[model samples]
Target: MDWDRHNRHIYNKVIDSFAVIGKELASPVVLAENTYSVDEAGILSSVLNSLKVLAGRHELKTHRGACVERTLITSIECISADSRHLKPLIIWPATTHRSTWTTHPTRGWHYGHCGSGYTDTMISLHWI
Candidate 1:
């Protein structure tokens, strides 16, 4: 809750300290990852929605997404007559699962129970 107040000349010491600690926590061994650019991120966004289209739904049961390395699909919800919302719930990419997709509670293969795996991993299940 601490933040620098009214002193533009002085650096944000608290934040700077944390920045160094953060770098140390994730050294070269941990800092490695597959990098991506904005365009690639856009494509990932498209990929998830594309999957939703294949599932035959425009409005998802709720927002859901998954990511691995540089390929991240952040959750997005458009409401309030095309309002925009974006939030990343899962930043810690999984190691075992390569492709991340969502399965709605209603669209579950068994109509409710079949989505446990997707729902559990994506954290986007609703109205089962």
Candidate 2:
């Protein structure tokens, strides 16, 4: 095996290109009217995670959330010791069949895996 600088550069370039393409790939947007100010890191991570799920043809799932006052339960939240802040709204389809609310040990909020019959479609949590 040869570890050449050219090979490393090419690998890095491919990864960088993938990241750019992933960002362009849209997700099941939940909130469009709502407002959110996410830093660069958050945006990058969100895009990367979304691409991980949307890379190939995925099965559908259920979509759920409580919408109140133009605010919906965000998919991602950044919390500290005492202050919990919501992250930017994102849209990513559930690859499994368990979208309905499930009981988790730590976080009590999950919106994925809703059973079969979910095809190519976008599911987004929103408020009226």
Candidate 3:
């Protein structure tokens, strides 16, 4: 079985096929690709830093660049200031002070972020 012929084309094809399947099974949301300018990145960084604080992590992002934003809010369950009932989900602007919940929050933030070629490499590594 000279599957390694043509520069291991067959082996690479198999790896690539599994890579697509792996990505599909690992993700539920499809994010649109976009280039983030410096100004937009700054604005996004501010919002993301605030979000991290809300999630209970005080450290801010030091890098300045674009990221393929994915919606992953794992820990949005600490929204109670006083002894009262609150909505299951709340979308409030940073300027609003209507809700009593003000404590900093954090998400699990522990999910694997693998892109197109990562899975193929991962699979290849597993076999090796």
For 27-49, candidate 2 gives per-residue lDDT tens digits of: 44533333233321112222122
Candidate 1 lDDT by residue in tens digits, 5-97: 436534677679879867765666543232211111122423343233333243343433452223433332322212332222222134343
Off by over 4 Å in 3: 3-7, 28-128
Which one wins on lDDT? 2
Candidate 2 structure, TM-score to reference? 0.20
Find the 10 residues in a row with the least total lDDT in model 3: 35-44
- Which sequence of candidate numbers ranks them by lDDT, best first? 2, 1, 3
Evaluated against the true structure, the overall lDDT of model 1 is 0.34
Give TM-scores for every candidate, taking all chains together and pairing residue i with residue i: 0.17, 0.20, 0.18
Please report the candidate that would top TM-score against the real structure. Answer: 2
lDDT of 3 by residue, 1-128 (tens): 23237566676787899899678655645332221111101112123422222322222244332433533221112222233322222222233233353354334211112232122343333322
- C-alpha positional error of residue 123 in candidate 3 after TM-score superposition, expressed in Å: 34
Which residue segments of model 2 deviate by more than 4 Å?
A: 1-10, 13-15, 18-103, 116-122, 126-128
Which has the better lDDT: candidate 2, or candidate 3? Answer: 2
